[model samples]
Target: MLQKMSSVQPFQFEPEHEISEDENIEDVQYQINQNEDDRKVYEVRVGQNGWCLCGYCLPMLTGKESVCCKELQFFAVAVPDIPCITAHTSFEAVCLNRDVLWAALVSLHDRESADLSYRYASYRQFTWWMHVIRIRNIYSEPDGIYAGFEDVDIDYTEIDQAWRDW
Candidate 1:
């Protein structure tokens, strides 16, 4: 599994933080280009964990990462809670719920990368260790409608037993 995980290094970064406090980054397009890998639509880490999309909340997908697997980068998207989360997932939520996904870019893993560091894609972009995120608004699941980040159940613990099974 370790060998398989290292295979895809899909990510890229910007010289500095691309998301500016003034740019009004309300939404983020997870995939703007073409190809098979661009179709991945990632889900947010709900439950007791909140809207986290990295670390234990994130589960490594099986097979080649043709989409939103760890291969994609998470080096720029910044949340007040998580250090550097994925802007794509975060932005998607923002588009769905105004109080979601819209975060600012803090920094980048590489110094010579582009400004859109928060963008997700298959490349040399910086990936993240903290792959967790909390929801910013009310959410409805098969179980029920959660009020907000504070209201979610966050089913996973430090190591999501369910994610591990996947």
Candidate 2:
């Protein structure tokens, strides 16, 4: 069994200016309106993967504009705290500011392949690989991901034997 707590408590007063009931009502209404407006504004949350719709594009998507740009950037520049490495890809290296992460991601997605003529598949493959590498690097740690690859040992005899067995 539990005892019921009393709802009433003794009030202590100190010297203070009194606010009128109407003034209090207005203040409360103002706070409520402000909160409502805040709710209407959309905010970007870090770590959530999605399109980086600019203010103008967002409004247009909602039928505010008859037509909107079909293309949008995907790669956001890496932030200082969130370090990136790009050695594996053709992109030598790229560092991002905290504000540019989203923009960078968008840019990567929107970037067009340079080999549009398709003279050689290798060219397209290389370009695509580089793009992917850049994206991967953006998510990698600052120290880098391939730090231990150089230390790996490879034996041609072992490889030949494994292939013969197969």
Candidate 3:
């Protein structure tokens, strides 16, 4: 269990019609919605292997007069703690910041690629103790999912040399 954050709420997935692992996952239709301010709650349907849910696309940059040029599918997944190298696929095991994690999965469009294309970092996340961390990349490999992060301590953020090096 995790302590509640200021604006985020923690939730668990309890399927109304729980099914066994041997059963088809498509049959398990369950969605857990949280408050509008709470983006942590999410929906997860059990699959044959475990969690095979794909993420959704980012908010499209609509209209001809849109501020941004292109609509990018940017997404991220936050966890209660750093995940083990081997347990990447089993995100639920470690606990997930559902909405963001789901968004990240949706961006992949059902592909299993680990490389991300966008250059500029769109989001920043903190660890369990609230240490600021810069999300470098979140991608999937043959083994499972991985989140690359850079610790942004005072030295890194304050020192000019450290900033350039990082």
CA lDDT for candidate 3: 0.33
The residue pairs found clashing in candidate 3 are 55-105, 55-106, 56-106
Cα lDDT of all candidates, in order? 0.32, 0.36, 0.33
| Model 1 ranges with Cα > 4 A deviation | 1-53, 65-74, 77-81, 84-166
lDDT of 3 by residue, 11-97 (tens): 322123436797654444322232322222112221121221232222322322221111211111233232232244444433465
The TM-score of candidate 3 is 0.15
TM-score of each: 0.16, 0.15, 0.15
Candidate 3 positional error at 68, Å: 44
